[model samples]
Target: MADSTGTQARDTRLYFPHLQTLDETVRFHAERQPQTAAVRCEGRSLSYAQLHQESNRIAHALRAAGLKPGARVAYLGKESEHYYEILFGCAKSETVLVPINWRLTAPEVSHILQDSGSELLFLEESFAPVLEQLGSAAPRTVVRLGATEAEPDSFPAWKATQPDTDPAVRVTPDTPLAQLYTSGTTGLPKGVVLAHRSCFAIRDALAGENLDWIDWREGDVALIGIPGFHVGGLWWATQNFNAGVTVVSMPAFAAGEAVRLIRELGITTACVVPAMLRLLLGEPGVTPEDFTTLRKIVYGGSPISESLLEESLAMFGCEFAQIYGLTETGNTAVCLPPADHVPGGPRMKAAGHPYPGIGAKVIDDKGQELPIGEVGEVCLRTPARMVEYWGLPDKTAETLVDGWIHTGDAGYIDADGYVFISDRIKDAIIVAGENVYPAEIENVLERHPGVAEAVIVGRPDERWGETVHAFVVAAPGDRPSPRDLHRFLAQRIASFKLPAKYEFIDHVPRNPSGKILRRELRDRFWGDSERKVN
Candidate 1:
């Protein structure tokens, strides 16, 4: 183990150097630390050996159910040991796991199921009504996640009948391990198909660098503060597991519960969004003592305000690293190390340097690389980039050029190679770490009878990075109340995507080409902030 000063130990060793796939990480740990706790969630724990055996059974059950290699298996539930069991099972069988955000509305959920062509779905019992609403759109095979072992269609009972022996299905590092859906500019969600290599690529790169921006040590207990559906949460969990460390899963992020868990579980490390850090700090009765065991905290998903960062730094009293990346880039390619996390440091405004093997550059509209200190689209070239955006070849071609993933973020790098994010090139709003695209919400709002035209813009908020704000042009002789519009949109879109504030306007400003001048409307709320994004 490395010492407290981040220096490498003389006896340093790679945990599973020979492992080529994600599932093999489980086997490697189980063989060495069978009795060690792999995961603890909801008052239940799974040892490494138990997790390996149960995942093997889950793999056998998938094959028994006639799911061929590369079949999409959907999981619509919160974080749990069962989720990882199914995730590894899919990896072992060479199947793709599609994790649906349970917060999405039925129609949104139905679209993902249809787009992925998932044959089997494992959902929590609480979300059964969502599946019911889908009816014919739902998969043919649906299994309840939490049920007694004696229950007929419960996940435990279903896997119990299957043999626990390893199926030993051939899988490679390039095999599609997960298909995570991210909202697109086209008013629909696009599936980001990630391969097994994403989980290990950055880790392997950091091994030779000896930098401890984010390191995992034995006895380290990591908190999965974000939902597992997002790439941030999935990647964080895999990193800890790959290091053979115990992970504590939160079914859903509750600030009060997170505070309690940190103290009770003696969590040593955590990866959370900025919004979660705010909530954890504001949780009633929370004190610095609650975070005594925390050695490091990794935060990203949205730009954190300076005030929050300073407050968090003083409170948590741990090393904080800020990560920056998109789902298309396999989560994090750039990390703001703890050394640069000074209160008023010049690099505090920057998003930090890239990993050892990662490449980041700013490009002009013509795809020409820009000189340092010039703001443009930030592009990243990493081994962890997604294989493709599912089946959309044209979209894949547009984003992934050469070996670089063109992140739709406008940012510049300094002479010292520090990345400083300015604003978003893509007109997507991030609310509490959840991606909300204006096109998707505008599509739903325009369908309302009283709404003639609708435009969505992000309004910076202190709590959530940004809140959805809508500008509407009422139909002739028709005026709709915010309450009425909220009700209409609530049923059609996810709650997080709903507009928090609305304005009645005569016309929406647009250019001659009829493209919505979203910046004009968004600028009214931003005023003169240094960074357009919160």
Candidate 2:
């Protein structure tokens, strides 16, 4: 097997030699750590060996159903033990696996299934109604896990009655192994295609590295609550699982349940958003006394304020690593190391330095490279990059060029190599010739006692062309008036940066991954028949 072309026709060897499919990645680890507990779901724990056998059973079931190689199968369900089986089973059969966020609306799921051409749908027993709305797309191959079947025409149950041989399957380096839909903030969801080589390259890339430098340990068990639909959740777990570490899964994140998991599992390494981290820390019994075993908390998604960060540092008494990357660029484009967690850090809104083998830089609107300390679009070149957008070749060519993924995020590197994310390229509000990054304004607003969470979007104004309006979620028992909220933020930032209008709400609409739905906020204002809201 040669890893080159323009030579004699031999076995095709991929760039990453370690793994070619999810099945291989899981099996290699399972064989090595057969006795290690791989999953703990609702009162059930499956060892690596048990997970292997169960996944094999799922593979056998798929084969029996006449699902061939390269078929797209989506797991439209929440995270659990069965989710892993469906993912690995499809991988073993050389099928593309798509995990949909259970929190999404029916239309969102329908779009994903139709866009991905998913032939099989593996759903949680509870989510059967979700699929019920999207009628016979892909023949409606429903996968019910451990529940009574729905009536006529519903799909088959994922039973483990039969045994399946761990068959040797082939996956080319370029073969698409999975499809994940993006946030669809700009428009419709883009199917981000990831190949076997790309996926394994990342897993293999970090395998030999010593996370010990970051205080990671084999003895550490992580409490993971991020939805598996997102790349962060799925791949972060993959990294730990392969490292022979245990991960306690939360089907869906709840502050109370996560606190319980941390207490019960002695969780040490957890990858969570700041919101979840805050929620966990704010809970009744989350003192340093309660978290005796916790060691490292890695967070990203969005920025955390200095106050929250410091409070969390004191509360957890562990290393906090902030990772920055997008679904398009794979993982760890930039990592804010624990050393940056100083008393007065400059990596304030920064995402941090690029990971090994990942090249990053800031570029101006004209596509020319910018000097350090200049705010521009952040871009990266990495082996872990996505091959292409599933069906948008034009958009693919625009975003990915000369092997660099032009991260739509607007930020720049400092003189010291730290990357600060200012705002989204499309999200930066241009008001009366002044550029206002929502993140900066939102950051200040979120620190206010009354503001629980904040999102900033530009609304059209006849005079300024656009003005900043805030959609804020107030803290419990606090509802400051729009005027008061504006006054609260006026001293923190410039007058123009102050949100002109405020809409108080119970909770800000956010994605399952905890990213504020800024697009939705914009749509609320932009979708109305009238324009230029005063």
Best by lDDT: 1
Q: What's each prediction's TM-score?
A: 0.97, 0.76
RMSD of candidate 2 to true structure, Å = 11.8
How far in Å is the alpha carbon of 216 misplaced in model 2? Answer: 5.0
Candidate 2: pairs in clash: none
Expressed as tens digits, the lDDT of each residue in 1-534 for candidate 2 is 323321112422112345555677678767777888887877678788877877787777777777888778888777887777777777777787888867665655787899888877776778776667777564457666546544432333345455756866776767776788774334366888877665555544443352332333546687776777777787677656545567688887888887777777788888887667667767885678767777788876555556678888888888888887777786556788788887576664567777656788899999999998888889988777888888889888988999999887877788877788765655756554344667777777888888888888987654454689888898888887888887777655557567778877677788999877777878776675222122
lDDT for predicted candidate 1 compared with the true structure: 0.91
TM-score of 1: 0.97
lDDT of each: 0.91, 0.71
Mind giving the per-residue lDDT tens digits that candidate 1 earns over 435-464? 999999999999999999999999999999
With candidate 1 superimposed using the best TM-score fit, by how many Å does residue 74's alpha carbon deviate from the native?
Answer: 0.3
The true-structure Cα RMSD of candidate 1 reads 2.3
- List all candidate RMSDs to the true structure: 2.3, 11.8
